[model samples]
Target: MLGPGAADVAFEVNGHPASVHVPPHHTLLDALRDELGLTGAKRVCDEGTCGACTVLVDGRPTYSCMTLAVACEGRSIETVEGLAHDGQLDPVQQAFIATDAYQCGFCTPGQIMSVVALLRANKAPTAEDVHRAVAGNLCRCGAYPGIVEAALRAARARRR
Candidate 1:
């Protein structure tokens, strides 16, 4: 049972119905990780500066840590876990692995999510566009070159 100030928020997650009972101030990140057991969105820099907690909300990349769970009611949330189907990774994910786009891997999920959003809109994005898309995600390992290559490769893979 939910206590005072707690409410149940129902939303679509990775095409599945998900419900979480949380207080008004509880972050979507917490609900996704704690209540829903979808931990692909990392908990780094809970303040939202780091994009490790990035998720796709209605196809737009959003920082889950900065978003309130209550605000997600009826919205669609997509995480890294949703990108794979039938044991096959999404093109973006495959590209990331092929290009070795990440190190330490803390920011990879967020970077991939951002790239996925970008690719949805522009399957033929330029390097500048890829860079712009992932600007919000910080990679301490400085893997920008590989990340950009992966984004472009993913775009190519999607086109073929």
Candidate 2:
């Protein structure tokens, strides 16, 4: 049986099955970065206040820092590292680069993930939709305008 503080969590990450041993207290962010060596989710606030550790859990944006690893059992997780396929970057990523959506690059991953989720749900998102999606993500460099432009640009690109 699993111990009081540990458990074997099984989940799907980036379309791959993952089974890892983790402590009950371990956050998904820790599991992703430490155990799996997936560092796309940065450890910033570590309290969910900042969206640096944002990832997609079951198609919805989630703050991995606040989500327990054990609680993620049987769930599907998608990190920024998984956004690309066959050597092609996700459209959101391309748009972020094209629009200069980031500076210092600390919050770019989270912002991109949020926009990815938004674009998945709404292929054509308005400025308000983009704002609402990334509302929780904080860009210390004051790159909100570029971020919004990137999201809109990605949405339009997806339509082509």
Candidate 3:
């Protein structure tokens, strides 16, 4: 059914379809960073504890580090690279920049992805919901308040 060392596999990245020949065990993070040169999805705790590797698989936030590249067949994947439109940052990204919601900036992409998913699901999220949505993303910079504020601001902007 298998061999010790296979050549590689291929998968579509972002919206463009392509095939990459990576080892069968190579993770989506490896494929994205090494094969596709899409480094937006950071590889933090590969065990899935950290949200740094977050990406959208069909509009849903998923840990790219833990997800196998093979599992993504025929599915649309969205990364932080896709958030900008015509050189303009998405609204949540803009709010995060205005609010200074990140420091050191290592976790900002995951944070922004969480906010994007939240706003996509709830146009008006309560404070508790905002907190709950970002619970999984850990910001070592201790910028939780700013992150919350950015989320609220994004919610407001979406409503207007």
Candidate 4:
């Protein structure tokens, strides 16, 4: 449960602790995009089918659009922008860019996050595993093949 007041939503985002005034009905996705200016996580198919609003909560991918901001009071949230470090992109991100894994880019962040989680779980996943890992994230541009190649490339890179 959230603390008292309509203006009392406080939580940590991307390692930064923050508090904001939001309506009780607002979702974590809305609060992140509209209030916190974190727009990397897309808001689409608000029912949670599209996986566009996927973000890392406690290092696990979550559908933010369906999650209440109050539920993240003490959880660590990570957006797509959080994947880079010291102005350098993470290997998965670089591989995505290199392999043209994104088309319109609307679903790229969520795809990357899902792949990130997948790679974390299986360092040497088979091609079928790659396909299954990203099946949940839908790309309107039909970049599935490129997405799989990107994940494979990142996986191979990590082994070096």
Per-prediction TM-score to the true structure, in the order listed: 0.96, 0.97, 0.91, 0.92
In model 1, the clashing pairs are none
- Which lDDT value does model 4 have at 120? 90
lDDT of 2 at 67: 97
- Clash totals in order: 0, 0, 4, 0
Give me the displacement of residue 135 in model 3, in angstroms. 1.1
- In terms of lDDT, which candidate is stronger, 3 or 4? 4
Q: lDDT score, residue 65, model 1?
A: 99
**lDDT per residue as tens, model 4, 36-90:** 9999999889998899999988888889999988777777888887889899999
Q: What local lDDT score does residue 13 receive in model 4, on the 0 to 100 scale?
A: 84
Arranged by TM-score with the best first, the candidates are 2, 1, 4, 3
lDDT per residue, candidate 1, 15-52, as tens digits?
99988889988999999999989889999889989899
Q: How far does residue 1 in candidate 2 sit from its true spot (Å)?
A: 7.8
CA deviation > 4 Å runs, candidate 2: none
Off by over 4 Å in 1: 1-4
lDDT of 3 by residue, 54-147 (tens): 8888888888888877666577778889888889989899999899998899888888888889899999998799898888888998999999
Clashes of 2: 0
Q: What lDDT does candidate 3 reach at residue 96?
A: 92
lDDT string for model 2 (42-143, tens) is: 999988899999999999999999999999999999999999999999999999999999889999999999999999999989999999999999999999
Two-way lDDT contest, 1 vs 4, winner: 1
